[model samples]
Target chain A: MTLYASSKAALRVYSESLAQELSSQFPGIRVIIVEPSGFRTEQNVLGYPMQIPRNPDPAYDSVREKSMQLYTSLDGRQRGDPEKAVELIVDIVRREGKSVERLGGGRAESPIYVPLGREANNDLEAKCTKMIQVVQKWKDVTDNLDHDDTNSVDLTRWGALRFFFLGSLHAYRAFQDRIRALASAGF
Target chain B: MTLYASSKAALRVYSESLAQELSSQFPGIRVIIVEPSGFRTEQNVLGYPMQIPRNPDPAYDSVREKSMQLYTSLDGRQRGDPEKAVELIVDIVRREGKSVERLGGGRAESPIYVPLGREANNDLEAKCTKMIQVVQKWKDVTDNLDHDDTNSVDLTRWGALRFFFLGSLHAYRAFQDRIRALASAGF
Candidate 1:
């Protein structure tokens, strides 16, 4: 779960940056970041607990192992439903895309981040605030590292942290087909 | 650089996942992650009077040495420069990108995490926070694992730490690009 969380955080930021680049460089290609929270999926039924490779060093901290174990415990018992999430994504994409140039320049703010469930919204908010807080607390140190003349500091605030709280990349992998199927259905 | 920072982090994650997959699935397109941090660049030309990688294992604390010295001075002055960052990438793409999409939209992002500068923001933050507080303060038992299931222990603060930090993969040498012209572009 340790590597998994960071991996997802990396994904979240990558998605945002990609969104920015794609939006600015190419027109007509819209990207919808569907950030879904936890769901009871086949991953819980099949993947975890035994899948993640263990760090064999005894000197290694045990908290990571415990966390993974805890995550496994919540398997198949998560809150959000994957079927509903896919259904929602299909619905949103279908409704969200609108060709503006053909419609007198009228445009609706497409839902850039489709947070799937209530738990996801809370998690997203929490990650954002904490990311800022961490940066704020470490502002001095982070600031000291840049070139003396450079006026700005680099701070990454990941907005999509919540949807990945469940550490279920495998679960998502297992369900990707289902979502893609739903999406292709008129999406 | 906010986006850059997160981009690298995302890349680190992406690279790891890719490496795992390519090794397991494709068996052809080998993936690698280059996690280099800190060097005597133009900035360090004025900073760090005695560049690191020279702790001869004395006086300096081990943690600081492990974190800074080992990172600060590579066995030799870092061969890669800010400009090589460009030339190196170009050489890679001249060969890396295959078709428009088959090269991989599955390649949403590739994690070639070239962690430049001693100021790897997140890495620094993690080392600092844990080193100071966790070591200076919670040194008693930061190693203990937990299973109490007390609701508030929202884990995942570490999901993104490692895959970004270990930062190494020997796969790059297979194509250590033959570019030298761009490295001297007044960088």
Candidate 2:
């Protein structure tokens, strides 16, 4: 499970960088990141129970045993609909496929990302929100770490700083509202 | 440049996970992630000037031209002290080599990540701080995405929640602080 999760995470990071890199050089060509949840695919239809041994070390035995039980229970029981997910992906790609003509006839806007299943959407949304909150919840502790080389804070600039900060914050809020609205609309 | 950056990012992610996986599974094994900045390595002594053309499209020619110029300039002028970096790594590894006995001649603490040069350290620190700020700046917008299925807004739990949140947040802050401090100290 650790290795599997790690691989998925690595792909996520790389896919993001790929999207960024491709954006300017080839605006019409997008590498959409499709986050697929577990679907009832041939590979996931477990034939037999998996063998998960607890760590040999007594210290890690508890976590190992808990993980083993959870993994064992998940075999053949995943709820995602793989076939429907594929159809949706194909539909999206077919729509975006129009953009290939846009390069000369290039550039079209396809959604940057698509979360495949209900479960996947929920997980991704929650994780994104939580991570955002984590940053919000700790902003103060991190914001002041830089050495004060200037030796003085510009008290007069506070008015301008606050205005700029609030303006950016408002724009950010609008963006988030759109994301949530879209997600709730079943995108 | 895009491909190079993407590939390096993926490896960095994979190597970190690998070190974590090995730390628990095989205590005797150690994986070191060496962040080598542009060492005056043999390959970097470019035999010839690199050729980078400005994009043909009139739209992106400016950025392409700028990037081409920057990349062309960095060919062999790297300030990294590679020999000294290697010597430092060797010394660190030697110190950890003694820990193998703790695992019954088994594993040593994975060299948790070693940044190899001053440039590498600067890049890592800047990236980390920026990421944290991004998360913080947009937290409020992301926080309200989910529908409030149960809108009681359990105000009573805020006390405990705040404590737990702060605890986790503090730990996270400490970790970041250590990273920057270590980078500054020439790790």
Per-candidate iRMS values, in order, are 19.0, 17.2
- Provide the interface RMSD of candidate 1 in angstroms, 1 decimal place: 19.0
Question: DockQ numbers for every candidate?
Answer: 0.04, 0.03
Report the Cα lDDT for residue B161, model 1. Answer: 27
- Of the candidates shown, which would achieve the greatest lDDT relative to the real structure? 2
Least accurate 10 contiguous residues by lDDT in model 1 chain B: B166-175
Give candidate 2 misplaced runs (Cα > 4 Å).
A1-10, A13-19, A22-68, A72-187, B45-68, B96-111, B138-187
Question: lDDT per residue, candidate 1, B71-124, as tens digits?
Answer: 243322433233333333333344342222222445423333223233343444
- Model 2 clash pairs are A101-A105, A102-A105, A102-A106, A103-A106, B27-B107, B28-B106, B28-B107, B29-B107
Candidate with maximal DockQ: 1
What local lDDT does model 1 show for residue A8? 58
Model 2 chain B poorest 10 in a row by lDDT = B160-169
